[model samples]
Target: MLKEAVKKQLHEGTVIPAHPLALTSEKKLDEAGQRALTRYYIDAGVGGIAVGVHTTQFEIRNPEFNLYEKVLKLAIEEMEKGNTPDSFIKIAGICGPVEQALAEAEFSKSIGYDLGLLSMGGLNHLTEDELIDRTEQVAAVIPVFGFYLQPAVGGRIFTFDFWKRFADIPNVQAIKIAPFDRYHSFDVVRAVCHSKRNDEIALYTGNDDNIVNDLLTTYHIRSGDEKIEKKIVGGLLGHWSVWTKKVVEMFANIKDVQGEAQIPSNLLTLGQEITDANAAFFDSSNSFKGSIAGINEVLRRQGLLQGNWCLLEKEKLSPGQAEEIDRVYRSYPHLHDDEFVKANLTKWFDERQ
Candidate 1:
């Protein structure tokens, strides 16, 4: 059961940035700088934040492990400048071996965060029994209000059936639902729902492109005149998206169609803008790692970020490529509410006209 206090206090909106902590010098920003970084994201309209410290990704860990405490302190300080703990869902991440997650989670819990995000994978993959053991151990101490485990990708979707077994673990509140591919993402949601597994578990679709469509619509698959109505799509997750605008709007739009078949018109419009830019961005980068780097650069130059170069890599977008992306960015209006914002809407509406 969702904690009464947690559920009651969950009305506020939260945002989780794809925590960027590239190990390179250029990408690494100090605690004060990171607090400033977090402030930018918070100012973008999130009531809370999810930060990671293990990888050069999202964690707030200072160079030393003890910084987790500092991260929490900084987050608290940053948030108090705008809101309170009850209004914020400050989630912290801890990833590594099972023992490491346990120790890290203990530290995170002590920091008094609203939630925790944990990750671990090694040696092809752990057996089902081992995964269950790990889940049991973690949830035992930490009030794992959520669990966003990545699917067995870079391997082959955990051979022992992770979805069913992991959901079986009590207090495993949710999963990020990152399919190795589109088909797998769709499959994971379908299987989870069909199996009635972890009925309360939130399914957060991390697949960027199809999120608006996939997490907002049910799938109708027919075979031999038999129609299967699947809620595999249209996830009722806690609204996690780093590729779009702020929370107040993101959650508002998603909640408008909770159980319905359609997303709000505005969301659809904004989603297309993302799709278009992603086309340009991805086309230039291609690799997932490269795509993140490219998008961060674009957001940085647009004055959306501090130009921390969140992802450090040997390759930088060529000056010509930078110009090309800026050209694409220019296509977007100053305010999302501008009349031109609905360019996609006009086209779609015209098709009906």
Candidate 2:
């Protein structure tokens, strides 16, 4: 069970970046670079970090690589070293089949992780009932942060019924809705709002394409005879992995106007600017083939990463992706955290040494 204070922190909302992997040119984990990235996130003032998710590359689970435990250990160590608050969330990504997922959940809990960001990718072979059973088994070991990944990625779609039942689980504390489809996104929200445990489950947006709007709009969902209100309290996003300081500041500004009768026109415009930047960073043009590498490119430019390397050799930036990143960099100087990283990159690295 989550401590009341930790649960309160999640309900109040905060930014939690989907942590990325730092690799050397030899395709080996750069221990120093990995530690530096963790320190960078803490210093950026983010409320939490979600490691081993899609942004961290699923290939890390391969026996050839076997970086799952090492990556999680590295992040928690840095979090401890930084003296983060108890409310600073630690999420370990849990994936694979029922047996593998259960083992990952148990390992994550043993290492002081607070929640397991459960992924349902590569499990289409299982029925929705079977999937729910799998989730229940994992939840028995640790609290769950349900993930609805977009099909454009490796994610498969789940029915609204699946979400309703999933939310009914007592150990499920939150959900990251990122199907990237407005209708499907609504399905998850409506299901959760209709569930008996709605109040206990925090809704976090994984929809990187619509981050600003998701946070600003409140949903008045109709479930049978009653109307229920729900809001996406925060984001656990891959887009946030880059320009984190700016993202943190953006989230704060959004929160300030969340309760206002009329949102400022400037904030709406800023949303498009952010989506435009996401298009470049996430490679929305080429079906996101370069998405992960695109994030690495930004960090590489900021000097946080030695290079943009993925476990899979074919996962490099797609054609014209670099130009798109450059265009956004030129167009939206306000959105980049280059200056923040510049002033602190040396210090972050120095701490690791």
TM-scores of all models?
0.71, 0.99
lDDT per residue (tens digit) for residues 120-221 in model 1: 544246766776687678877664533333332222354325666666667665555544266666555554554444355555554444456554565654
CA deviation > 4 Å runs, candidate 1: 1-5, 8-15, 21-28, 53-69, 85-87, 121-125, 145-156, 194-197, 219-247, 261-269, 279-285, 302-306, 310-324, 334-353
Tens digit of lDDT per residue, candidate 2, span 221-314? 8878989989999999999999999999999999999967899988899989999999998899889889999999999999999998899998
Q: Against the unseen true structure, what C-alpha lDDT does each candidate score?
A: 0.50, 0.93
How many Å off is the CA of 120 in candidate 2?
0.2
